[model samples]
Target chain A: MSVLVYTENWDGVFKKLSFELVSYAAKVAEMMETSVTAVSIGDVADDELAKLGNYGAAKVVKVDGNTTLDNQVYTGIIAQLAEAEGAKVVVISHNNTGKALAPRLSVKLKAAVGAGLIALPSSTEPFTVSKKVFSGKAFANVVLKTDVKILTLAQNSFEVIEVGGTATVEASTATAGEAKTTVKDVQKQTGKILLNDAEIVVSGGRGLKSGDNWGIIEELAEVLGAATACSRPVSDEGWRPHEEHTGQTGKIIAPNLYFAAGISGAIQHMAGISSSKCIVAINNDADAPVFESSDYGIVGDALKVLPALTEAIKEAKNK
Target chain B: MKIVVCLGNVPDTTTKVKFGDGTAFDKTGVQWIINPWDELALTRAMELKEDAGNPVSSVTVVTVGGKDAEPTMRKALAIGADDAIRVDTDARDAYAVAGQLAEAIKDKGFDIILTGIESSDYNGSMVGGMLAEMLDVPSVSAVSGLTISGSDVEITRDIDGGKEQVSVATPLVATVQKGIAKEARIAAMRGIMMARKKPLAVVPAAEVETLTDFVSFELPAPKPPCKMVDADNVAELVDLLQNEAKVL
Candidate 1:
């Protein structure tokens, strides 16, 4: 049996997410004393296919198609591949696509699943997977008991390693049933990184005073090459787009760094960003709950703190 | 058109989370409420039913929980759901829960099923997808906007770097998130009074094999107090981030 990893490639290029999944799959495969097989549904170039090997994939299968990510079809194809390869463990990312397809695949394969998995199984014997729950405030160690197990790794939780190797690449195709959902339109955001994909995020809140006063926050984010986010109140007040909001009622993100300016950390807001690797808060109130959660705190007007911090970051980058 | 909005009973969002048993969630002194996202989904379903065309014939709410989950179901009925169904059981796992739901609702002939993207407690966002698979239907994930036009069900979902507007027929599932409705609907006094009269069917849960189980839980460690950085020496903050945190 093999460990199968669903490596998502966009426009024939694999991103950090794919490598992470492959890396995770390789480790899980090692635990099970099996080989790793990577699967890509859409068009991925030969050179790009080899990259999966660097992360320990022994074999990579490129399913040639002009893929339009239909969850059912994808599930069918993956399930078929798993059966053909005699896969005992399957790895997928706990993102939008995986969110929709993993369960279907689990049901189809009659395999147990642990979604939002943060770490490798604490015990491979029982196949216990550690995952974040309660909005990252707590951790749950879930055990998958079935012979076949499915795991959707949480984003940014696992590091991508170049474990020096190469994978055998092959081309194949399979027929899945018709697609019921039609993608009518897709509007891509430009000029900024998406919050979900960002490594560093700079956010503002009600303390920013007004929508027009967001120049400092933007300037800092631009200097850091990071995405800009806002609190729920900022979005509700129309200071920022609803898409930029980060809180319990808004987007939940886990970036490498979360920089908050002029925001009092509400419990709801904290729930969204508590998973960030490092957090720095800039607020005039020293006692703001944000300070309690942040690694670094600057008690001052965000309007001034932001610009100075931005200039400093720019200077540091140059040096 | 008929709709079934799956409701998950969770502790109030404001409630401080505590673990009673090692792996089981603590429920003592906690107020149970309909999950926020499910409430919003129900509100949107209510709006669709009350639309001018009245294209929607009925709205039903379903849950996989024990007797403690009934109050939350009643709240959904008060929020305008036509009826409620409780699969009397604990939500042991997403796969088992979905199996129970599919067994209970397969012959019910509901055209559309809506579920929150995830629950606030466990946040296991797998049930909706499993529902679609179990019933052999399509599902839209990360759904931000859901609307009905004639017979078409329009669903807008949040993708990685963009938004995709998709359309699908009924017998589909849409896992809902924020922006499905402007605000959660508040039940009026009359709605509450009538909700008491609404029918709540309690069905026995299917004896499905549990695939996953929680072995243990651990609360996150307390973060150290923030290192104070003077606003005047903002450059020092950068130095600390670089040398100390190594995040720069």
Candidate 2:
């Protein structure tokens, strides 16, 4: 039996999450007493797939194609490869694309699957996996009893291990099913970090008061190299775009550090980012719910707290 | 035109999660609600139906959950769906849930199928994609805006680096994202009163093809104690990040 890691690529370059998954998969493989094989589908270059070796992949399976992530077709291919290689464990990143493919693959392989996994599997019996639950408010460990196991690791959950090694590349011949969806065009966001992948997020709420005053928030985000997010109320008020809103009723994110300035932590807002490793809340109200959920709380006006925090971060980065 | 919105009865986002002996979440004290994203989907469907000048014949909400989810299902009807269906089963995995929805609507002939990008509970975000594949229809994920023109639906989505716009024919599936529609409307008092009278059909789930199983559930390790550094000590904070936490 072998462990299979799904290596995701964008524009011919492997995503950082793919390396993270490989590193985690490598650990799982060691526990399973099997080597890890990294598989890349779509139009990824040979060198791109070869790079998986550095991330602990023993073998690289490159399936040459121009497939645009047709879920059924890709699931069938992965299933065929898993069966042929006798893979006992499969790992994928918990990204948009991975989210689209992993569940179907779980069904195809009849494996117990864990999504939103945030840590490595437990060494204890039954092989439990921990995953973010309730929109990141809490985490739950999932144990798999199935012989074949599937795991979708949350992005940035594990540190990437760089044990550069050579990976044996092999060409796999697999037939892809007809794609039901066609890609007409892809519109790309300009000059901003994708909220889902951002490491540090600086979010605002209705306290910002108006959309015109957003320059302060954007400036802080720019200085910190972080993404900008807003509360549901901010979005509802049209002070910020909906895509920038993060809450229980919106997008759930798990950044390394989340800075909530000029925002009270409503249960809804906390639900989206409670999974953040560290949260710093700067609000005038000491009784804000956000402070209760935050790792650090500063009872002060955001207009003052934000500029000071920005300066501090800038000075720290410069040092 | 007929639209199908797949809804999941999910725990409130703030609910504390307790892990079972195996890797399944404990449902104790968890208040169930319509998955937030699904609410967006339902709202968008209603918008489309209204925009079509009532050309749409029906908007059906479907879920795979026990009878306790009926109230949440009725909430969907109150919000504007024509009817609701609860496929009697506990939603264990994304694939099984998607399969149940797909089978229920296979021959029902829906022009468009909508679901949230991901449920707040499991965060699988794969059900819509899998359901689209199962139904053999074009699919789009995380659509922030949609406009139906003639036989095609123009969808705008937020991608990794940017936004994307695509056009697909009828009988397609799309996952609703934030900003896709206006703020979801609360059930009006009249609608809430009328919801009790709406048709909420309960049916046993068709034999589903199970792909994944939950062996058990456990709580995550407690976070380490937080160490506070003086606000003026920027250098110290940097040192802590680079050396102690090693996050940098």
Candidate 3:
């Protein structure tokens, strides 16, 4: 038996998220007294595939020739690999692609699935794992009883371990299934870091007054090298794209650092970001609910405070 | 074409979650509403049915909850579902929930099935995909945009770095998120009165093996009060971030 992990790559290269999954799988394999077999489907380069070994992948199953992710086709491939390898536990990341594929895999393999898992399993016998539930407002320990276990690691939850090793690479014997969907078009977001992958984020809210004044939020984000986000109303008011909205009804993010400028700490907004490690708030109202959750607060008009904060960060970074 | 949009009657977004029987969600005095994501899906279903160009015939909303959930189901009809189905049991996990739904929806020949990406409660994010696998049909996930065209549906799903558009045949499951609709449509007074006459079927939950039992629930630790800083001392905030928070 082996621990099989599905690692995702972008443009023939792997990112921190993939490495983190392999790292998590490696530990699970060790706990189960087995080895880790990592699978890469699509256009990941040879050298890039070798990096999985650094995180304790004992073998790499490379499936070539797919440029884009077709969820059903990929699901068929991963499900077949797990059955052939006798995967005791199948590991994957809890990102968008994983969300689309993991549950399908669980059904095909008859495995119990734990999505958005935050840490290593507390026990391997019952296969108890912890995952984020209730939009990060709380956590629950789940017991997976099926013989084959499947887990999707919550992004950035586990540390990437670099253990010296080399993995045997093999070409996948599984072929693609019949495609049921046709790709119509693609619109890739350019420039800034994607919110789900960002480590730090700077956000604004309705308190910012106008969309044109968003230059201050951007300036601060530039100084901090953070992604820009906003509350639902800010996006609703057309001050920012809906993509930037972070709330219960919007995107739920858990970056290491989150800066909320002029955003009130509403329960909806807080549900999306309460998992953030450090939250800093800047607003004119000293009694705003945001202060109750923020690690630090500056009671001032965001329009004025944002520019000043940006300049201070620039000066501090230069020093 | 008939559409079945699944609804999750969960605690309101702003409700403070408190545990009741150690791990069970405390519902006392907590106002429940259709899950935000599911509400959006219902809104889109209504829009599709209302549009003159679309082939949508009827829209049905289904939920896996007990009798108390009927009020929430009535609200779904008020929001514009043609009918509602209640599974008549509080499911143990997503796996069982999907099985119960499959039992209720199978052989019904619904052309399209809609589910939210994740419920605000539990946030399991699995029912739609598992239901599709059980029914042996194709499915799309994290769908931001969906439109029916010539007996086929074009879907826009979120991928890393950007968006991807794909088209799938009917009798498929599609899990959607925000951007599918501008905002959830509230019930008008007329719609509310009409909902009173709508049919709500409460069927028994199917017996399915439950997976992943929850051992316990723990609320996150609340952060200490924010340290107030002077606007003039912006540099101090930067210093604290770098030295104290160590997140720089």
Model 1, span B69-106: residue lDDT tens: 99898888888999999999998888888998898889
Once fitted onto the true fold, the runs of candidate 1 whose alpha carbons sit more than 4 angstroms away are none
Best by TM-score: 3
lDDT of 1 by residue, A1-319 (tens): 9999999976678888898899999889988899999999988888899989999999998898837878899999999999999999999999888888898999999998888887888878888888877777788988899999999988888899889999999887876988778989999897778888889999999989999998888888888888999998898788898789898768878898999898999888998898888999999988899998999989999998898898898899899
Which tens-of-lDDT digit does each residue in B1-248 have in candidate 3? Answer: 99999999888887778887667777899898999899999999999999989989999999999988888999999998999999999868888888899999998989999999998888878888889888888889889899999889999998888888899998899999988898899999999999999999989878888877988988877678788889889989999999999998
lDDT score for residue B90 of model 1: 92
Q: After superposition, how far is residue A19 of candidate 2 from its true place, in Å?
A: 1.1
Please give, for residues B14-55, the per-residue lDDT of candidate 2 as tens digits: 676776565556778879888888898899888888885546
Model 3 over residues A68-149: C-alpha lDDT tens digits?
5766788889988998999989998888888888888888888889888878999998789877777877888889999999
Clashing pairs in 1: none
Please report how far candidate 1 places residue B238 from its true position, in Å.
1.1
DockQ of each: 0.80, 0.44, 0.80
